[model samples]
Target: MTDAPGSEGPEPSEPPTSRREGGGLRRAHSAADASASTTTGARSARAEFETHVAHARAEFEEANERIKQRTGRDLILAIVIGVAIGVVVVASLIFFKWIFLLFAIAATSLGVFEFVRALRASGRRVDLIPQLLGGVVLMLSGYFVDLWLHWVLTMVVVVVLIVWRLLGQMFSRDGRTYGAVLSDVLITGLVVLYVPFLGSLAMILLSQDGGEWWALAFIIITVAADTGAYVTGLTIGRHPMAPRISPKKTWEGFGGAFVAALIAGVLLALYMLGLPWWTGLIIGAVILGTATIGDLGESMVKRDLGIKDMSSWLPGHGGVLDRLDSILPSATAALALFYLLSPLAVS
Candidate 1:
């Protein structure tokens, strides 16, 4: 009021330091709040990213599963078709042994062709004519021609073909593929003889005194075993047994097959075809067990050849091998069973 100009201002408020310190406290609190917000935002962003990644992974898995399902359905379809044809053909040849024999020979020839194709797929160049002749010889060997003459023809054909092939290889200007030749021959032999050998026994069974019904029962048992395995595996399959070769097969499936086969055998004895369920039971157990070996054997061949199916002739079904793998071994067992039980032959 007295001296300095106008004594203006109003009280000067408080000291600048006191005001600044209050402002400083406010700034520090605000900065801390901002930092907390930043951290929370970062955590939320991370959680969102993780959720998106999980969604993507689940979608990928679902797509893969769908592909496998479609593949399995196609395969099952083919097998059913092929099996149906076979059942019809076999049923037709029920009485005429010669007609059945001819069918068996032709079927074996087709089988040999498929096997050679598999070998060739594995990079083996095989001579077709010699192998084809050998298969023909094997298929016809079961015919009841003049015993001595048939034997002579079989021995001569085998010797001449083998020698001729070997000489061709030894004198080849570009060298021969012994691996291919041997593999082709061996595969052809197995293919031609495998089913015919087993089927021929059924012929033998039917020809015996009043053994027609028993022969029919013999065929029925194999169908029963295969049906059991397929149905059971599709239902309660859990643990994968062989994913690389056969993804759908499970140990549980095998157990079911065994049980089904055993029951069918019993039924055969009791009612169906009048096989005497007790005898059917024994036959069932033997055939189912050995049939597993045949199934695995074909699997082994496919695995070695790096092939999925033996061929693509039948739609939905892979090849003749695919349909026959499990049943082929059963043929041998059935034949042996017949010899053991039938009146005509003794094993």
Candidate 2:
């Protein structure tokens, strides 16, 4: 090696870093950095997607697990009985319209029996004969008369029940307390409105032009709402709707019920009822409130009376009242709403 100018051995070779080369190097660095960033981002996105899928699957399994835990043979039996009753009701309404009245009378009778018997079980003596008579008359009035007559006859039946109770109390030798008589009268009146009054609306509903289809649509929407409530309550129900009345009910279930009712109502109005879509929505909301309240109201009765169910009239279905709990208020609401919306529908 030869000595270089200004110092040590041969001069060290300088690195090739001209302006052009330096610019190319910078570009290469930028490209490499961009490629690396792209790869990292892609990996992160894939990981996130996988996490989301896992979470969704887990939630689904949890919901199913809850259903599995809550469902049993009793529920299955209830479904069977309900389906049979539903088929009978539909056939009656569609094929033999008059025959539907017989079914209504029978249902009202049974509902009255169950209601009064439950009160009796709670140590409250109810005059079953007068109550049954009044219930039958109340239900039949809907068949024979217009809506106004129906109401008028309902008042007539109420007065008849009260008079009958008062006469019986006067004739009875037993020292019946005034409180007991008052309780008897009050409960008897409630039964009149609760069972036959509401059940009679079905007859009124059948009096409409497309009443047959309207009845079916009402049943379908009610079932849908009830299903939504049952499923949602079983799966994710956390907040109690009325814990004292119905331990199984929940706000989440109500939400599910509302959504299901809304969807069913819209579809039925559009395709079946020939009404405006909003009509179904409003009717659905009405039915939802009334049906839920009816259910809770009955539950309150059972709770207050200290009974599990009205009776075991239908296996696994508790009683006629239990199965018809939602039907009563739903029928009334549907009939009233239909008449309100369509003046011509009123008979």
What's the TM-score of every candidate structure? 0.67, 0.76
Local distance difference test, per candidate? 0.66, 0.82
Cα error of candidate 1 at position 104, Å: 1.8
Which has the greatest lDDT?
2
Question: Per-residue alpha-carbon lDDT of model 1 for 178-282, expressed as tens digits?
Answer: 676685455444543454454444444545554555655656676777778766776776766676667677887787888988888888766744445467678
Segments in model 2 whose C-alpha atoms lie over 4 Å from true places: 1-73, 343-347
User: Cα lDDT of model 2 overall?
Assistant: 0.82
Name the candidate that leads on TM-score.
Answer: 2
Q: Give the per-residue lDDT digits (tens) of candidate 2, residues 135-213.
A: 8887777777888988889999998987887888789868988898898888778888889888888778877777877
In candidate 1, stretches whose alpha carbon ends up further than 4 angstroms from where it belongs are 1-71, 75-83, 145-161, 176-215, 242-245, 272-275, 343-347
